[model samples]
Target chain A: MICVENISKSFNGRAVLRDVSLEMQEGETLAIIGRSGSGKSVLMKHAIGLLQPDKGRVLVDGIDIGRISYRELRTVRRQFGVLFQGGALFDSMSAFDNVAFPIRTFTDSTEQQVRDRVLRCLDLVNLSDVGTKRPSELSGGMIKRVALARAVALEPRYILYDEPTSGLDPHTSTTINNLIKGLADQLDVTSGER
Target chain B: MAALEQRLIRPLYSLGRYALLLSKGFTSLGHFSVYRKNLIVQCGRVGIDSIPIVALAAAFSGAVTTVQTAYQLVSPFIPPSVIGAVVVPSLILELGAIVTGFILAGRVGARIAAELGTMRVTEQIDALEAMGLNSIGYLIVPRIMAGIIMFPVLYVTAVLVGVGGGLAAAVATDVVSTGEFIRGARENYLVFGPMFGLIKSFVFGFVITSISCYMGYYTEGGAEGVGRSTTQAAVISCVYILLSDLVLALVLL
Candidate 1:
């Protein structure tokens, strides 16, 4: 479970998040919907320990994220995966390498194991054939799918999706939403609660 | 009154902001290992990768130094051997440090700033932060580390190639015997010359990396902003390196 308490954040003395709070229980999905610049992403960033609040706390599984040491933060970070708004894949690496990046960085997986896991994630996203392509070569939809595959690569207990369907067609958006719902159902992953 | 206040206060505010950013960059170096692999990649890209160009520049500069020095000392009283002594010290002190620094500013510094600036414009840095990664640790540390390590190596390579080219020029022009040139170089008070060059390289590396990273990390706007950052990285790093070289020479040399 994750809980955020009275988070307040300001940039250049202008408040972006003012006394925002939220909570998510195990196996629950939460959608953070708001207008542009309504502090949705700021709230999510605070929850994930990316930004420390001025006068609040974020507790992940009873541990205050702001109070944790950096070494401990790595452990906290490994527990969740975030699909960025624009699919921040490394431009120089192929999709397969991009998917395998986190596993290679944070785990002791062998090359074969990394490859197998990457292929499995790609298959899950129905992007098996596109593994060798760079992000520039992929369509907008394919890039998002690749980003989703990379986000879920670590089998994270929680996944955060920011504007996941912002640029996709209705059909593709439905497909992604269904995929997220299916992944949550099958893997027992928690998402943002509404 | 308002115009005067704006002129003074705004500039002061900018200066203060720059100081704050410099402090932040210094603090960020503590977690450098988080981006160790990336540093190695940048070192390969910036240092080892720019070897051929640095060598070519050094070689030509060395040949030019030999020719100019020999021409100026056309008097028969001053042996042509003195050219090696003059060239080696000058190369190690000024050309070796400043030229190599400028080359790196143009090559690696601009590239890093542009790459990170693009990432900034594209929101990748924000994405990393949102993923619970320290943007400083993930991005800046590796680059600084690579710069520090490779700059000295590049400096030494420059010195060797430059001196070798100068010697070849001396022999080819029949201005000085090979033995005379080598002996003159050996007798010179440059026992600590390479050490001085390395020290300069270290300072140059820090200046180039910090300035370039600062420009890139704080870039705004879009593609034009990125281009501006790249230009700023190259220009600012070169100017800082040169100014610091003078300061270091007064203090250390």
Candidate 2:
């Protein structure tokens, strides 16, 4: 579970999020609906401890993220999978390697195991055939799908999607929505969408 | 009062941020096993990839220095071998490292800044952090290690190529015979010459890598910001390299 309490954030003394509070329980899909520049992404960043609030605290699994050491914060962060607005794929790596990255980093899986898991994640996102493509070569929709594949590669407890379907075509957006729903049900994962 | 505080505070804030970034690069060194692979890849980037340019620059510098020195020593009493003496020490003690430092300040430093700045703007760095990875350990550490390791190797290469170029130019220009040049170099060669150059290269390596990494990592805005960081990285690396060169010469020599 993630709990944000009275969080306030500002940039250059201009307030973005003020007195915001929320809670997300396990196995739930929560959507933060707001227009662009409405701090939806900022709020999501706070929930994952990516940005600390100027005031108030974030609690992950009952431990206050603001009060913990970085090592402890990383331990908390491991429970999350974030799909950033830009897809945030490593430009140097292929789609397959990008998906395999988290798995290989956190697990002592053999090469074969890593490959199998990466392919499965790609399959889940319907990007099984584009694994060898770099992010630069992929279309916007394909990039988002590959990023989604990478996000769920570790089967994280909570997956955060920031404007995942924004700017995508209606067909692609529906495909993404369905994939998100299917992955949530299949993996039994909590989800937060902005 | 407010304006004055802002004027005084901004540079200090940047300094503090730079120092803190360096501290993070050192402090949060994650698994060495992970670093080993990255370090090797970076070595190839900073070392093996840089040889041609360094060699090219060193050769011209040495040839020019030899020709110029030969021109200046127009006296019956001065042996032609004196050109070798002057050229050898100049290349080994100063030109080799300084030239390489300047070249890399533009080449490697700007490249690091652009790469990291792009990552910053693209949210790739945040993505790495979000994944519970030590982004510093993953990105900066290997680059820094490569810089420190490769700079001196390039310096040695520069010194060797520089001396060879000097000898070649001396013979080709009929300024000094090959044997005379070798004799002069052997006679005037000091144990401290190459040592000082090596030391300078190491310091320059750290300056270029750390400053550029700091500039790149903290970059804000977008494409314009990336261009700004890349330019700053190159400019600042060059400035710091020269400044440190003076300090090292004073302290070490």
Candidate 3:
């Protein structure tokens, strides 16, 4: 569960978010609809521990994110998987490695285990055959799917999506929406989507 | 008064931020194998890829130094061996380190800045952070390690090829016989010359790479911002190298 209380943010004295408040219970889906530059991304960043709000506190599972120890913050970070506005894939790595990165970084899994899990995630996102390609080689939509695959690679407890459908076609977008719904049902995870 | 405050305070703020960045970059480091793997790759890129150009520049400097020295010392009172004497000390004590430092400030520094700046604009750095990784440690440390390790090696190469170029020029111009050149090189030679050169190059390596990485890590905007950062990295690295060169010479020599 995540709770955002009276969040306010400003940049150089102009307000972006003013006293916004929200909550998400376990396994719930919260969709935030706002116009462009409406602090949607900033609010999302705060939720995922990426940014801090100027005048409020964000509590993830009842613990204040701002007050956590570094080790605890890292542990909290592992619970999240985020799909950035752009794909944000590592340009140097192949699609397979990008999806496999979390598994490799946090897990002591074997090579076969890593490979199997990476392939499974890729298959889930309909990108099984594109694992060998680098991010530069993939089309924009393919890049988004690869990023989505990477987001869910660790089977994280909470997933966040920011404009995940912008660069994708309607068919692909529907497919992704379906994937998100299915994954939520299967994994029993909470999600925040914009 | 407002403009003065803006100009003055901004740099002070930036300086504080830069120092904080350097400190953050050096701490809470983990993931050894990843760092080691990245270090090896950076070593090849920063060191090996830079040799040909460094050698070429050194050779030109050496050849010209020899020719000019030979031309000026045409009097009977001056021995031909003095050409080697002048060239060897010049290459080791100053020329090799200075030339290699300047070249790499343009080559390696600009490349690092541009690469990191691109990563910044593309949100790759944020992505790395999102994945529970220390992006600075993962990206900057290995490059810094690679730079300090490789610069001295490149400088030594420059000195060797530079001396060879001088020897070759001597043979071509009939300025000094091989035996005379060797004798002159052996005259008044102290281990301190190479020692000083190595020390200067070492510090140069540390400054050029770290400064470049710092500039790139903080880069904003888009492609045009990347170009600006690249130019800034090159120019700043060169300035730091030249300044440090003077400091190193005064302290060491």
Q: Which candidate achieves the best TM-score against the true structure?
A: 2
Best-matching candidate per DockQ: 2
What are the models' TM-scores? 0.87, 0.98, 0.96
lDDT of 2 at B120: 97
- Please, what are the lDDT tens digits per residue for candidate 1 over residues B1-253? 9889999898688568666666654564444444767878888987899899999999988888988888898477897679878888888888887778999999989998998998888767765655456676667767877888898988988888899888888888888888888877877957677788889999998789877887898899999999999999999898889799989889887
The interface RMSD values of the models, given in order, are 2.9, 0.8, 1.3
Q: Kindly list the per-residue Cα lDDT of model 3 for residues A1-194, writing each as its tens digit.
A: 99999999998799999999999989998899989999898998888677888999899999899888655776787888888888899998999999988898889999999999999999988889998999999988888889989999999889888988886789988988888888799888899999
Candidate 1 lDDT over A1-194, as tens digits, reads 98988889998799998888788999999998888987887787777776789988999999999998765775787789888777877777799988988788767888999999999999999999998999899988888889889889889899888888888999999988988898899779988722
For each of the candidates, give the backbone clash count.
6, 0, 0
The regions of model 3 sitting more than 4 angstroms off are A69-71
- The better candidate by TM-score, 1 or 2, is 2
What are the C-alpha RMSDs, in order, of all predicted structures? 3.5, 1.0, 1.5
State model 2's lDDT: 0.92
Chain B TM-scores, listed for every candidate in order, come to 0.92, 0.97, 0.97
Per-residue lDDT of model 3, residues B1-253, tens digit only: 9899999999898789877776766775776875788899999999999999999999999999999999998569999999998998999999999999999999999999999999998888888877777788889989998999999999999999999999999999998998898799999577899999999988999999999998899898899999999999999999989899888878777
For candidate 3, the lDDT comes to 0.89
Indicate the residue-level lDDT of A160 in model 2: 98
- What's the CA error at residue B11 for candidate 2, in Å? 2.5
What lDDT would candidate 1 get against the real structure?
0.83
User: In candidate 3, residue B194 scores what lDDT?
Assistant: 94
Clashing pairs in 1: A29-A193, A30-A192, A30-A193, A30-A194, A31-A193, A31-A194
